[model samples]
Target: MDVIVETRYGKVLGREEEGVRTFLGIPYARAPQGERRFLPPEPVEPWTGVLDARAYGPICPQVANPLNPVDGFAQSEDCLRLCVYAPAEGTGHPVMVWIHGGAYVFGSGQSPWYDGRAFARDGVVLVTLNYRLGPLGFLHLAHLGGEAYASSGNAGILDQIAALTFVRDTIEAFGGDPNRVTVAGESAGAWSVGTLLVTEAARGLFQQAILQSGIPFQYRTPESAEWFTAQLLDALGLSPSSWRRLFDVPAADLVSAAARIPARDGLNLRPVLDGVTLTQSFWDALRDGHAAHVPTLAGSNREELMLWVARESEWRALSDEERIARVDRMWGPLTDRARDYYVDGRTGDELLTWLVRFASMRTFTYPTIRAAEIQSEYAPVYLYRFDYRPSRLGAAHALEIPFVFGTYAHPSARALIGERPTHADVSDAMHAAWVAFVRSGSPQAPNLPEWPTYDPKRRSTLIFDEAPRVEDDPDSAERELWSDMTSLSM
Candidate 1:
């Protein structure tokens, strides 16, 4: 079965699968190639004939990795596309728009693990989109000014706003309600949602947002971002006189140049604090009740830092004194608290995993707490802590994606989580909670524990463990430790 819908960019034929109709590689904007590399996305021209959107689009150009086996895939610059999945017999179902995460440097909406079929099964329309990344998506060239470069260092986020506007203007033709939309994401995507929540440009586009493993703390200052952009040009052998040379350089060269650029001391290449598109930090806006009306769902996993700590063989070579010293430096004054909870008296590999987990919790816990505090004033906020450990990796980063999407048979799913049913029920509960939230503002579901909205009084949280339960203020000890340290609210 097929459904042909007329979009502003002309007609598109969507293919029907078993239970859902899917449209893939639908262009929301014109390709940002050549002269338009660092510029804002342009409106896609209307096509006279029907566009066959049966296949997934190409992923954005990214740096390839040798040690990390998964990064070895075909990538390109012509990747500003979107994929949509909705019920075949749809009328007015709620919608969920997903944004993938890879530290704002890599990741695409085209990954098989992000398949929205399960979301459609859960009675929601799911849309995943791809936008520019790396230098093309986030560089702040000092010369470009005006609305053409108004978004500048934050082109990736502007691309998202454009995609949401497209959805707001056109999704009704596909049998989904525009007003009942929920935007959700993990890691950098979660941070992007945080950014969207505070922006005046994103007003009324989404009713609810889910931030998984991230909050407002993950941002770079504008001055720093501009400095990094200048360094990139210098490394490419282009004089300041030839700043415009970046526009003509081959896309492959730009992507390759990204690989050679060293990590900014300790900073990641991400959405920067350009004063135009993003005037104030997300924390500033959330603190001043800017996002008071927006409902939010925020949380971090139990073993969130295992992957970052164990990505390479760096930990193996460190001596005991050096290792423990490194841990102390990472945790600083919080080392005592982390040692008390995670390490206790553990040593060697056990201690390493414990410290990694503590570090991740330290980084994310405060931000999530702050976000909850600010948003709870106007709307219900759902808070959670994923503590389900699947084998040695524990409950590492991105472990919850497949579970929430209910794609147990995906190849990457099997790779990330081994064949185990120990945590399957937890996934079912979480996915159900997500679907219920989209259906209405409340996340209450039948047969599940009564999930409470976050409040300063109870500091209530949904504890997702072997036996899922609602706990009153699970992170009180840690929250108290960071009270004085919290300079910003969200």
Candidate 2:
């Protein structure tokens, strides 16, 4: 059935399946092309007639990775669009906005893994959105563009804010409650959720947050951003003085140039501390209780780094001595303590797997713990750790996404989680908890036990495995070793 709803911009024709009404490719903001490129997102221009929002919009421009491919999606500069899924009968359902993760480079709202039909079936309105990516989104070019591009570095984040604003003003027409919105995501998207908590521009945009497999602190300073921008210009054959020519450079050329810049070059083109759009450090803001006082659910997967390690052939073949040197270089003075905790008696593949697990703790798990600790000071924070090991790969990064979205049966999911029978029980428990959090501030659901809130003393964390259980200070020994380390590395 075709359903037509009148939005602020104009009438949008959506399609209905079962009891869910889906409206895809709705322009939340104006097309970010030509003059609007790299600038703060502008409000969508009012339309004349009903807009056919049946198909997914073009995804943000990025270099495609064949290894981790996003199948059957168009890409273009006019990619600042969002999708909405709501129950056909509900008038005031809670809204859950999802920001897809792709290391701030790839991924989009159109990813099949992020389908919102399941959420609609559960009586929640699900909204998925796309923001600028890569150099076009996060490049720090304010030093060259000056006043016209002060918020250039954070253009992607600003796009999210704009989408939320549109939802606030217009989602009520789509059977959603503007005042009852929860923002959620995994990895880079989760990082955005954390960043939004402390962002003044996103002050009243959401009522709660859910961060999965993400770090709350990962922003480059202005000095570092300037250095990265200089290198990027060099890669594009533009000198510092000719930096303004970047606006004229083709988007494809810019993306290619960005992809060529090595990771070791210190050219991190992620979010930046621009001293404007992002005024303060996210960590400092959270610690000082400057973040939103809304309830939060933050967690990461066990063996989170194994996914990356599984892709690296050279790292898998490293000698014991080489592994020790790599660990020392990465962990600094904590190498001995970490080795004793993780790789003391292991050898070969077992040793490498343990090393990857330790790296996961340092990079993803510990940072999430710190975030929960800081957030608990101001509001109720629930912490969790996903331990449901798949067939080949363990509970690695992004492994919990399908379970949370109730899309475990998806073909894409089968690649990550083998062809074995899907874990329907775990999916029900996890998805219910997510829906519970969106509707009410707590993640407590009937499918799971009474989950307690997190605190510094107990550090109660829910471990999601075949038999899920709550454990207080799980992995306490390893966590204690990093207690003195004030900051977490990305």
Candidate 3:
């Protein structure tokens, strides 16, 4: 029997399996197509009949390789949907709204890695959503298109705000508590959560946040956004005057063109720091008390760059000269300082391994700590360093997703964890911490170690290894390397 629920917008049908009531592919906003392609999302109108929401919805337009699109959904521009996983036995459970990460290029709520059954079974209403990506979702048309397109650059983040609005207004019907919502994500999704912290429009939509391996680095400023916009327009062969042609061109063209525009680190076409949508100081937003009411759990993995850099043959084959030059660029005058600290100078896998460590920290880890230090002043914040190595990749980016969701047995996760044996104990502890945070404001899981709130002086961070434990200021020597530099972006 189909379970029917009436939301404020309309009645929808969902499926129930294994003690979880899952309502998939529910539209949060009208199809962002035609004139609305680059505009902010518009609310979905109320439908008269019961809507079929058993199947997952189409994901935003991107290059979805038919063989293995991680989102595991069809592609289209009319994609502004979310999936809700509510416990079969609950009426007022705390909500965890998960945002799937793909460097703002791909992935959707239907990502197999983001299965929410664990959260549902543990008495939390889990919501995962899809947002715009690449040129269609993030291209900056405001400067060329004028005031009408002022927000065109930030349409993706706006899509997220719209999804949060949907949750706030309608989550009650699905057995969730609107006032007790936690907005959580990993990687770009985690960056999006951090972005939402400063997004004035997104204020009060969520009460707590969980950022797992959220690379805290470069965000697109207006100047940078315009440069990216220029590149995309050129890729499409559209003159400045003919920018309007974007509406008529096929999304596939946009996707293909976006792939050609190389972005070594983040400024490809993700969320822009449009003064209208995002504030200037992204990290300071937490310190300034924009989200004083919200507590936070923020952390990065042990070797964040390894997962991405390991597969790139070009990166693997860098000469010592080229390697030193790249490090110089990343650290500037601090290059010698970094060289002295790194100490490992042999080439091949050894140098690359050490380089990965330096890049991950220089690019991601330091910024994360600085952000946490700022946020810790106003509200309670818990820090963590995920040290569980899944395969030789060594606890890299997105490795914690399956563990956080407790989807340990998923095929993709199996492939990622590989034949070297999986760790259910790590997954269980990590997943429980997430659940505990969602239910209460703290991540003090019953089975896990005592997790104290973070303070700048001590910098207590829970290490999620085979033996999960809390330590004060892990690797302080490496962290202090970037101390003099007030601002850092990879």
The candidate scoring highest on lDDT is 2
Per residue, candidate 2 scores C-alpha lDDT tens digits across 1-490 of 9999998888999999899999999989988888788899999998998999899988988888843475768888889999999999969999999999988888898888899999999999999999999988988878888988888999999999999999998899899999999999998899899889898899898999999998756688888888878889888889989987887988888888888876642236778889888887888888777665789999999988877777667776789778767755563334656667777898888888778777787778888998888889899999999999865678988889988988888888887886555488788889999999999999899878779999999999999988789999998977887775543542
TM-score, structure 3 vs. true: 0.95
Question: For residues 1-490, could you state the per-residue lDDT of candidate 1 as single tens digits?
Answer: 7778887678889988798989998888878887787888887777899999987767788775632233444566777888999888767889889998887777888777788888887789999999888888988764544466756688899889888988887788777888988998998889888888888888899988888988757577767776787778888888767878888887778877876776653344787777777888777777777677677888888778775566657887886556767766654434455557666687788778767756776667667887788789877798988888765667777888877887755777777677777657877888887888888877777746888899988988887776778999886776775664543334
Highest TM-score: give the candidate number. 2
Better model by lDDT, 1 or 2?
2
Worst-scoring 10-residue span by lDDT in model 3: 64-73
Give RMSD (Å) of candidate 2 vs. truth.
1.9
What's the lDDT for candidate 1? Answer: 0.78
Model 1 residue 363 lDDT? 64
Q: On residues 19-56, what C-alpha lDDT tens digit does candidate 3 reach at each position?
A: 99999999999999999889888998999999999998
**Number of backbone collisions per candidate:** 0, 0, 0
For model 2, what is the error of residue 182's alpha carbon versus the real structure, in angstroms, after optimal superposition?
0.4
